[model samples]
Target: MSMPPVKKIVTWLLVIFLLYAIFTSPSDAANIVGSAWDVIANGVANIGRFFDSLIARS
Candidate 1:
């Protein structure tokens, strides 16, 4: 009934859901992680290019 207990219940529910997803559809989880990593890699590459352009200008 209180806020803290409610939050804990929701958190546990999400953990269960994630565990179910991971066990039930591992390939889909792998794809999701791969796509996320790709996005992060591309962002870092773009930042490196921006710094390189800045250095070239100076």
Candidate 2:
């Protein structure tokens, strides 16, 4: 609410924004992979749920 505290908050916010911009630049890259693993994880979860339902009904 006071002037000094408001100025400090604005300065800190500016510093954080600059740091984030430096990290996420296009020069960095990733080794890409297919979505097969995602699909497999989902499939296993579905199978577990199916068995759980069967046991619940018995």
Candidate 3:
């Protein structure tokens, strides 16, 4: 199946913006990535805790 034109355009735009940001200010880009990683990790940890609690209750 083919992706919609609008979705493709938006994806390309985001890619271009990310590349621009990375090249223009690498440190800032690194910080952004780090922050995003922390958020994702924390979210996963929270989900794991939720499941653990559910299992413990059973």
Top candidate by TM-score: 3
For model 3, where is the 10-residue window of minimal lDDT? 11-20
- Candidate 2, residue 27: CA error in Å? 13
lDDT of candidate 3? 1.00
What stretches of model 1 exceed 4 Å from their correct place? 1-10
Which rank order by TM-score, best down to worst? 3, 1, 2
Clashes of each: 0, 0, 0
Minimum summed lDDT over a 10-residue window in model 1 is located at 1-10
- List TM-score per model, in order: 0.73, 0.43, 0.85
Kindly provide the TM-score of model 3 when superposed on the true structure, using C-alpha atoms. 0.85
In candidate 2, clashing pairs total 0
lDDT of 3 at 19: 99
lDDT of 1 by residue, 1-58 (tens): 5579889899999999999999999999999989999999999999999999999999
User: All candidates' lDDT scores?
Assistant: 0.96, 0.73, 1.00
Cα RMSD for candidates in order = 3.5, 8.7, 1.2
lDDT by residue (1-58, candidate 3, tens digit) is 9999999999999999999999999999999999999999999999999999999999
Q: Estimate, for each residue in 1-58, the C-alpha lDDT of model 2 and write its tens digit.
A: 5579889899999998766765675233221223556678899999999999999999
Candidates, ranked, lDDT? 3, 1, 2
